[model samples]
Target: MTQAFDIIIVGAGMVGAALATGLGQQGIRVGLIDKAVPADFDAHASPDIRVSALSAGSERYLQSLGAWPALVAMRATPYRRLAVWDETPHPLSRLLPGSLTEVEFNAAQLGADHLGHIVENSVTQNALWQTAQAQPDVTLMTGQGLTSLEQSPDCARVTLEDGTELSAQLIVGADGAMSQVRTLAGIGVTRDQYQQQAMVISVRYLGPPEDITWQGFFPSGPRAFLPLHGAGDQHPDETWGSLVWYDSPARLAELKALSDAQLMAEIGKSFPDRLPHLTHIDAKASFPIARQHAKHYFLNRVVLAGDAAHTINPLAGQGVNLGFQDAQCLQGLLKEARRSGDDLANPRWLGQYEQQRRPANRRMMLAMDLFYHLFSNQIPPVHLARNLGLGAARALPFARNRVARYAMGLDEQLPGPVQQILHRLPGLNRI
Candidate 1:
């Protein structure tokens, strides 16, 4: 038997699950399909290597979907300050004789308690999954991979490997970069792979949990530190943090192959002196850096969201945050369509989503690309220019606060529907 739903979402990652739960809460029938459900989160488990810096906007939206509190109860670390510095020496710096180039942003300057939260991807996904499972309008089909997808003017149809068939007025491609739904829809993506690989290590440190995150740029790339919450209240002494080292693939491999002691020593030698001392390496992994943008967000009755729509460089840690913004924008549009009794798959409505998000995402991608090329260059002139810019930015408190607010995803004027949703959410009217 072919089950019918108002919408079928492919992939149950954080973004997909958020969209599903939002729609289901509105009384729209939602079919959420994923290859596998996230395993239960253990309070005592080591921190996951994959993490995202979620902005205030994302926090509000998740709270609206009833997932934020669960995530906080699981594990969430708030970062109140951000520091970026370039340690490279230039002829100008030697002549002028000043402190090393560094810029800092403080949440207190903006009257906010935190600029953002660094959260494990799995924890957020599991929280959203719980919300989805509790909604009567949501039907989750787990362990079922997509085998075929067919879309027509009236509806989109999908077949799963487990022999289950489903149809919906619209099909959402919330899958990651290698999205099957996007492929089947004949949408192509423009991709650029950075030669650098990010080596991520989770470590147990001796210091108390910190509220600041920092990054230092070298000729190779940037080394970043992200603070994480402890396992639970019972283990207050067990503090954790993540280290991101960006470099050529070969260098990453060499680093990854080091013994735990050797790797810890290497980190101490290479990273800035301000980085905390690590007592233990809990986990380690590496992934290539790449930027990908879909040629189109939607075609016919099919559409894309999250990584399926675009993937950005992780240098600024905005990858998943962008995905959440995509979900927020698309959910607003779809909600309006459902309320008006219009075809949810209407090309005009889908085009609006594409038009609204594509350019914004492209701008961010290009900004990161600019940063990658500019800061990665070691020429004396380039170094001097960047340092000067950083020094100037450090002196401009108003501009720094503006940029910090933008990074927190508060600069954008929320759309009408999204604003209404936020207003209805208790304690989020100001967000």
Candidate 2:
């Protein structure tokens, strides 16, 4: 069977689903596909226990697309405080080297109600899926994979593993880091693998579900603890919260083999003093990490979005946030093109999408790599310099604000308040 739509999305994950929701809202007919959906593993209910620190800018894009309310309505956690320090430094200081001295970001200085929210990957994707269900123009096909893609100057033909074919002005590869559609589009990736692996654990904390999110940088990587909302007031018994501890793959393997009681004890010891203590009710899983970038964000009638286009080190938890930016940029650009009577499949428009996103995403990938390398070293001098840099940035309110703006994805993402906030930062003048 051969069919066509205005747009066809090859991946149904967070990014793919998000673009589908956004385009569907604009009355664009979209065909969204995913190789498979989560099989409902309570143990791995959330793929890769880590949650994304969605920047306020990305949040606004999702909100405009009508995905924010559903995300919030589900089980997302709002973060007001962001604390960071060197791993060797004890969390007990409650202070950077000086008062409030810490790494390059602060929520209060950013002038937003909060930095952003920590959302379970599953919850975010699920909400987007639900939203897609309500849109009449969006068609979803799951449990099928992309097999072949052929493109011409005017249009593209996409064939599925099931021998079904789709022709569209544009075919999007939102499949993921190992995207089949990307390969079908003949796009290659520049890649790197971080030596560290993250152990993501969801636990029950003794205290009320707090609103702060914090991380401690260690020689291996960084350990982040994010507060997720509780089950509800009515269900009083169900506990809430999640923590992600980044360590060497060898170290994580040893830890994962430990019994539950032993694992909780290790969790207590591994985190910095600033993070709250949480009892580990669930078994922990490990994620061996890496970095991936699409050689091209678009080609002919083919384009990439989300993990299908770029996969960042989750060190700062920016993967999905970047993907959201891709979705928004693609949607905004195409929406305008359609309105102006321009060809949606025009290579010029597709080239602009690549030009705008490629440089920005590449910069982010480099930043993550730099941090991962510089901090993952045990060299005393580098450690001391990193600590002082964090402390120094904290002291410079202007610098701190700039760092905050960047972290929130506001500076690089949207136009309104986030952009306004970023413009005031003198520190960002050079970048």
Candidate 3:
């Protein structure tokens, strides 16, 4: 069988689904394809090992798509405060108290209802799937993986593994970091894998749901906490949350081999004292970290979005937020293209999309690299400089808040000085 639409999106994950819903709502015909559908949300199940700290701007985008309410109903933890600090100890550290080096951003201080929400990846995918499926102009084809991609000067077409064919004026690849569509389209990526591997642990702690998420950086990497929902009646006094331990592959492998109880003990000893008393460990998984960017955002009649185009260091939980921003930009551009009666894959429009998104994505990748390199070392001068930097951020409220607003997605462009600093960083321009 064959299907045709204005656009066909491969990979119905959060970003792809969002794009489908947004475009469909605009009365554009869209075909959303995926290998398999996301599992339904199970309220009684343990929290998914994967979660995203969605920023305010992402929230607004979801609201516009009419998915935020469904996501909240399914389960989204709103955290009002976020904290980061240096956990590396040194002789010079004695000069600075913990308060001086620790930085925290509060919604109250920023006059916002909340900083952001901690949402499971599955929950987000499910909510977006429902919204996308509801769009009258959207056709969703699940359990259909892309097997071949062929693009002509006029349009693009993809063949699924089941022998089904779909064609469109333009094709979007949102299949993630290891994007098959990108590979088949002959798009290459420059990838640099970090030495650190992040192991995400889903655990239940003895407390109500927290309003804060925090990360304490060490020479090894970062030990962070993201709050989840309550543990339910099964454990009345407990709340679920996630812990992230970033370290070398060998160290993480050793940690993973330990029994749950042993891992819990290690976490209690190693994590910051601010971490609540963990009562149970529900899940643990680890993966290597990398910074990857596609050589081009588009070629011929095909384009890329989300992790397919770029994957940054996850130290700040900004990956999906960047993906959301990509969908928004591409959606707006496609709408403009449709109104102008231009080809959906017209270079004029895709070029603008690349011009607008590439720099912003590159800037974030550079920022993460700066932090990864700055904190993952023990040089006396560098160590002292980072702590002093944190202290300076605390001392300079206006500057600190401006940066915070940018991070929180409350502001669009970063402050001029910060962007200039990121742009000037050595070798960052190439990415």
Candidate 4:
């Protein structure tokens, strides 16, 4: 059988599902394809191991799509402060005569109630899926995998594993880091695998939920704590959270082999002193870290979004936020194209999307690379410089607010006219 739609999106993860819902709500026909449908979200169930730090800008986008409410109703942990510091005792600190190795940002300082939320990836995906499925112009193709993809001058076609074919004016690749749509479209990626692997564990804390999220940097890597909402109607006193430990692959493997009790002991020793006492561990997993960017965001009648186009180090928790931003940018361009009666697959339109997003994404990638290198090294000079820099950042409130706003994705949410004006200014796109 064959199906036709205005646009067909491959991969129904958070970004893909958000794109589908956003377009469908605008009355554009959208076909959403995924290999497996996510199981129904239960508020009382244990949270998924995978979670995302969703910024305020992402929350606004989801609110517009009617997904935010569902997510909030299910469960979302709002963090009002972010604390980061280096635990390394730099020899230069003695010479510098001051300890400035710590920085913190509070929502109150930014005139916002909360900086962001920590939600399970599955919860957000399920909410977006429900929103998309409820839309009249959206078609869901669950339990179906893409077999092959071909693009003509006028349209893109994708073959399904079950022998079904679907055609659309444009095909969006949101299939993630190993994007099948991007590969079949002949798109190539530039990838750099960091030597470190990240260990993620979901745990329940005996104390009250924290309003702050923190990362303490060590020579090996940063150890992060992200608070998660407690299951069911429990109060903040009964909270859960996630722990991320980054280290070399061999070290991570060694840690992974420890029994749960031994692992808990290791965590207690390695993490910052302020981390909450972990009463129970719900789940644990690990994966290598890498930075990947598609050589081109689009080609012919196909385009890419989210992890399909770029994947960055999770040190700052911006990977999924960047994906959501991609969806927002592409959705606007497509809507404008539709209103103007232009071909949805026009190269010019896709080019514009790429032109706007690629530089911004590239700048973020570079910043993360800089951070990864500066913090993960044991060089004495680098350590001294980083400590001084952190101290300087703490003393500069104006600069700190700007950085906090940028981190929260507010810079990308500026009015279109203002954004265009800023984009024309050299180096402004990155902020």
Specify the highest-lDDT model's number. 3
lDDT of every predicted structure (CA atoms): 0.80, 0.71, 0.86, 0.81
Listed per model in order, the count of residue pairs whose N, CA or C atoms clash below 3 Å is: 0, 2, 0, 0
Overall local distance difference test of candidate 4:
0.81
lDDT of 2 by residue, 214-298 (tens): 7767766788877876644543554467778787778888988888898878877877766665654564677767777777788
Query: In model 2, where do residues sit more than 4 Å from their true spots?
Result: 38-50, 89-96, 99-101, 104-110, 231-238, 370-377, 380-405, 408-431
Give candidate 2's whole-model lDDT: 0.71
**lDDT tens readout by residue for model 4, 1-431:** 67999999999999999999999989999999999867987767888999999988889999999999999988889999987666666665454322345557788987989989999999999999999999999999999889889877778889998899999999999999999999999999888787788999999887777999988879889899999876436545568899999999899989989989999999999999998888877788997788788999998888999999998888888888888889999999999999999999887788999999998787666555544433445655443333435333333333333333444454543333222223332322322
Q: What is the lDDT of residue 341 in candidate 3?
A: 94
Count clashing pairs, candidate 4. Answer: 0
Q: Per-prediction TM-score, please? A: 0.89, 0.83, 0.94, 0.89
Least accurate stretch of 10 residues (summed lDDT) in model 2?
A: 422-431
Candidate 2 residue pairs in clash (backbone atoms < 3 Å):
91-273, 91-274
The weakest ten consecutive residues by lDDT in model 4 span 417-426
